[model samples]
Target: MLASLLDSMADSLVCSVELEKTKGITVRVYNESGKLTQTVILDGKSITIKSQGEQKSSTIIQKEDSIISEVKGSEQTSTITQKEDSVVIKCKSFQVDAETVSVKSSKDSTHESGGKLTVTSQKDMSLTSSAKAALKSTQAMDLETNANLTAKATQNVSLSGLNAELKGTTKASVASDTAVEVTGVKVDVKGKAQLTLEGAITSVGENITTVKGQLVKVEGALVKLG
Candidate 1:
C-alpha cells in the first residue's frame, strides 16, 4: 500500500504541475520566486486563506442557509470593515478600502448595522520601543482620543421646549506622558427659550424675544444679522 501510494503521488504530479486539493484539505502556496504566497485550509465546507503581506488571515467566508419571514433564503450576509481605526458592517455589501470600510446587509434596510470610521493617523508601521531604539522612528498617534459630537439615540428632537441630557466621557493627552487629562462641555436645555447667548443674532427681520438677553451689536463685524 505504501509503494502504491507513492506511485500514485508520482503519477499525479506528472499529470499536472498545479496542486490539486479536495475539501477538508490544507494547501499552501508559494510564489515562483519561492516566497510564501498564501495558505488555505478547507474545513469540510469553507476555505480560509492567509495571504502574503497581510497581518491576519485575509479572507474567510462561509456559506449557509437561512429562514426568513415564513420563507427560507440563502444566508448570504457577512462583512468586515477596518478603516483607519474603526470598523462598520451593515449588509450584503462590505468593502475595506484605504480610509473607511463598511459592510452592509442587503436583507433589511433598517435592520441591525455596524460601522466604524478612523479619523486619525494612517501609519501602517507599529511603534515598538526596541524598534525605535534601533532606528529613530517617531511615535505613532497617541491612544488618547475624543469626538466632537457624541450622542445616544434620542426619543425626539427638542424644538424649543425642555432641555435634553447629553452625556459622554473624554480623555486628553499630549505626548511623552501616560497620564491623561479629560474635559467636557455640556449644553443643558431646561426651559422654553431659557438658554440663550448673545453673540451676533443674524436674521431677516427684527429678532426680538422677551427672555434673558444680552447687548446686541452687529455693525462692525464682517457678518451682520438682524
Candidate 2:
C-alpha cells in the first residue's frame, strides 16, 4: 500500500514513513529540491499535519473534539464559507497585529466588549451613516478637538442640559434669520471693555429697567426716557 501510494506521486516527490516506539508514526514528504514539504505525525491520542510551500507554512492539530490550525506567511489571504448556523471562536485572549485589517458584513454585525474597548488611528478617522447615528452614555460624554469642531444639521440642531454655556476667548457672535430671544428668571449681559447694542429696532421691556454707568450717554436721532 505504501509503495503504491509513493508510486502514485510525481517523480520529483519523495515520501518516507518512520515508526518509533514512543512517538508512534511519522510520514514526511520532500520536494524536488530535497526540502521537507509536508509532514504528518499520528500518535494514539492526536494527529498533527504540517505543510510548507515556497513562502507559506501551515499546521493543523486534531485531538478528540477540538482542532487547531495556524498559517503563517508574508502575504496571505483566507476565505471561509459556512452554509448554515454560525461560526464562533472562544479563547482566553485573542489579538491580531497587522498593518491593515478590514471586516465587512452583508447584513448586520455587532461587536461587544465585556471590559474596555478602544480604537485609535494614527492619521485620520471618519464615520458616516446614511440614516441616523446616535451615541448614548450613562454617565458623561466629552468631545474635544485640537483645531476646530463643527456640528451641522439640515433641519435643526438642539442642545439642552441642566446648565449650558458657550464661551470664546476672542469673540463670540449669535445671528438669527428672524428673531433672537433670551429669557430666564434673571438675565445678565456684560462686556469687559465696551458693550454695543445696535439693530434696526431695539426694544427693551421689563418690570423695571435701570441704566447706570460711569458716564451715561444716549445718542440717537430722538431720545426719550420716562
Candidate 3:
C-alpha cells in the first residue's frame, strides 16, 4: 500500500510539471528587433527569453536593463543585475581590449585566488592612501636584487622596535658630519671591531673599555671635538 501511494505521488508531480508547461505565460512582442521576441514564464523562479535567429533562447533567473542574469545551462554568460542595494555581475569569460583600464571601489575590496596573480607595469607604479596600508604574509618576506634600497625623510628615519638587526654581505656607509649613536643596557659585539675616522671625532661621555674574552686590554677617555 505504501509503494502504491508513492507511485501515485510521483505521477502527480510529473502531471503538475506538464500542466505548468502547458499553462505557461507567453508574451509575443511586435516590431521587436535585436531584442527579446518572446518571454515565457513557467513560474516565479524561472523565465525564458527568445531571440530571433541563432541566438535563440536563454533561461534566466532575473532580467533587468536589457541583461539576462543567472542563466541556466552549462557555462553561463550574462551581465549586470541589482538586488536591493547591492549590484552583481556574472559571466563565463570577459575581456576588454582598450587603451586604459581602471577599477575603483568606494569601500574596501578583497581579492582571492587559488592559482597565481601577476601584475606588470611599463613605467612606475605608485600606491597612496589617506590612511594606513599594510601587507603581511605568513611564511617569509624576500627582497632580491643587486640594486640599492634607500629610505629618506625630511625629519627622521629610524629602524627601531625591540632589537634592530642588519645582515649584509657588503659594507654600510654613514653620512659625513652626522651623528651615529648606539645606546643600550649592555651592548654586545661578537665579531672583530674596527673604528676609522678623520681625527678624534667621537665622544662617549663615559668610558670605553676594550676586552678580549677574559682580560681587559685598555680603558680610554672620549673627547668631544667639533
Whole-model lDDT per candidate: 0.44, 0.79, 0.55
List ranges where model 1 is wrong by over 4 Å.
1-23, 32-35, 54-57, 65-226
Largest lDDT belongs to which candidate?
2
User: How do the residues 1-226 of candidate 1 rate in per-residue lDDT, one tens digit apiece?
Assistant: 9999987665442111234355566666655343335666667665455555322224544434311111112454444544454455546655466766556664534433355434455564343443224322254433333434333434532323245333434533233234333333632335454533333443332355433447654445376333
Best-to-worst order by lDDT is 2, 3, 1
Off-target runs (Cα >4 Å) in candidate 3 are 1-57, 61-68, 75-80, 83-85, 90-96, 112-116, 158-170, 176-178, 184-208, 211-226
Q: Give the lowest summed-lDDT range of ten residues in model 2.
A: 77-86
Q: How accurate is candidate 3 locally (lDDT)?
A: 0.55
For candidate 2, the per-residue lDDT at 6 reads 75
List model 2 lDDT by residue over 59-111, tens digit each: 87787766667666766533222224554444455689998899998888787
